[model samples]
Target: MPSPLVVLSHLRWDFVYQRPQHVLSRLAATRPVFVVEEPVHADGSPRLEAIDAALGVTVLRPHTPVGEPGFSDAQLDVVAPLVRRWAVETEALGACDAWVYTPLATPLLDAVEPRAVVYDCMDELSAFDHAPAGLLDRERDLLGRADLVFTGGPSLYRAKKDRHSSVHCFPSSVDAAHFGQARPGAPALDEPADQRDLAHPRLGFFGVIDERLDRDVVAALAAAHPEWQVVMVGPVVKIDPAELPQAPNLHWLGGKTYDELPAYLAGWDVCLLPFARNRSTEFISPTKTLEYFAAERPVVSTPITDVADPYGDIVRLADTPAAFVGACEAALDAGDADRQRRTEAMRAVLARTSWDATAAAMGRLLDAASRAPSAHPPTPTHSSTPARATSTL
Candidate 1:
């Protein structure tokens, strides 16, 4: 039997089905996967709420009296004992692997004697708005303990490479068939009610609206094109929703499930990535870039380092609202030949990677670690190349 995978994550399993959910769900097909979410404040004593989230995955939501929900020291103090007890009761500690997504979760490592420890650094959390205190110190602790470290993008890999002995870049990947349902002439999907009434030439974006999003660009886009609708999906987080720029053409329909995203994408004429070039967005590799590509929609993005370096060839990069508007106009006015050329380019990009290939590569590393003599194995020679992942459409 495969080793049980115990995951400590800042993201909730049911929340946006991004990196952790995508990779773990694929990993769960072979291993028993248990995800311990950041704590939720409750009046009562600390406890665990286990929900069978998928075929081989169990999501453990910790309820603590502490106000903070992230993996802070206080939260670790409350969650460690609780999770240890749960692991003991469930007999999941034996021959298990601890997969960590946040540095603050390092304290929880004392709860288990796993075959190996994996730090899957998906984001530069310390730079995010309202990040907890002592995050950098905790990240140092996690990096020291982690047997292997996986960065979500090339930019992140560069930032973390020198800090850890073993670091690998696994950039965001796409689910072509899933998002391809949005392509023209594909099976008709039900239009979401919130977006159904919105007028066309829709320029859409889906993902958490936080400090990273350039609100001015969004407002400017809507203001410049009264005939065109700017539809922003996903939950508003960290930043105050009241602070968001308002306009007649702008509509925030809020978050939708992973299954419902394609329906919304199908109706969009152009996809957007209007990220602020701030500390919070320095290392981000927006997954929506590939998702939009899979939908065969023309994409316009701020020149985020990760997105620009690898995808500037295919995606339109615009920083100013006027340039953004111009790019969108170009996208909307493109002839069939241009669209087809972009579609073919996107397909070539999508063909290079997938979550399945990523998980498998990770599994190989885990297996190697399990077979090694020490919990932390000797570092393999560092390479600039990203993990070689191949997938079939």
Candidate 2:
């Protein structure tokens, strides 16, 4: 039997399915995979609870009492023991690898003397809104301790590659076959009632409507082109709804399931990546960038570095709202010949990049590092996962 794999993530297992869900689910088939989440206070005091999240992976959550909540100081002290107990039991069985998404999980390195420690830097968390205090320090510490470091994008790799002994850039990858359902001839499910009867030439943007979203840009673009219906999908977080710009052409569809996306995407004439050019967004490699290309939708985005640097030739890029609206107009006016040309070019790119390959590469790196000469001595060789993983929740 293979050794156990423990993943400490800042994101809840049920939160938007991104890199973590895709990679870890596949690794679970051969290794005992446990995705541990920050404490949840459904009741009082902290206890570790594990739920089977399919693919033989377990999602463990630390539940603390509302009064003694959070993973800081005394609270962390309480939560640490419960976590340590679970980790010790798992490690006792065999060698263990601790894969972490957040630098804040640096404390976990002590709880589990993992044979291998992988720091998957999926985002520049220090720059996000309401980021925890002293996060940079923790990240620096994590960088020092990590046996293998994986950055989410090129820009991030450039920023961090020098800081670590070994670092690999694994940009946001895609599940092309699923998003390919948006293409013609794929069976489109019943369109959502609200969007079914809506006007044509729908300009759509989906994903978390958060601080990274340029709401003003969206409003301005919608108002400038009222004939084009601008539909924004996904949950609004960390910002007040009242703060969002309003226009007759703008519509908020809230969040949708992974299954529902292809249908909505199928109806969209153009996809919008209205991301703000701020610290919070500088290094974010939008997962949807590849997804939009996979759907064969014409895309117009602000100067998102990761999106522009790679896909600028394939997708349109403009900074100001006026320029963004103009780009959208150009995309809308694109002839079939022009759209087909872009589609073929993009298809070649998507065919090479996928969540499966990324997961396999990550697995190889972790497995090699686990047996490498290090502080924690090696055991038997670890097993390789059969495939890349994906998940609904």
lDDT of 1 by residue, 32-102 (tens): 99998999999899899999999889999999999966887777888999988987888655778889998
Give TM-scores for every candidate, taking all chains together and pairing residue i with residue i.
0.95, 0.92
Which pairs clash (backbone N, Cα, C closer than 3 Å) in model 1? none
In terms of TM-score, the best-performing candidate is: 1
* lDDT measured at residue 111 in model 2 versus the true structure, 0 to 100: 78
In order, what is each prediction's RMSD in angstroms?
A: 2.5, 5.3
Tens digits of per-residue lDDT, candidate 2, 1-393, equal: 456888888787776777788888878767888877888766655678889976768888887774543345555676678878877676443567889988877887677778888898878888888888878998888887888888888778778777876778888788998889897667876788879888988999989889999877898887887788998989888899889988888899898877788889988999999999999999888889889888988999998888877777788899998899899999999998988878876776786678888888888778878878374423322122111112111
> Against the hidden true structure, what lDDT does model 2 obtain?
0.80
Off by over 4 Å in 1: 373-393
Model 2 CA deviation exceeding 4 Å by range? 66-70, 90-93, 373-393
Q: Measured by TM-score, how close is model 2 to the native structure?
A: 0.92
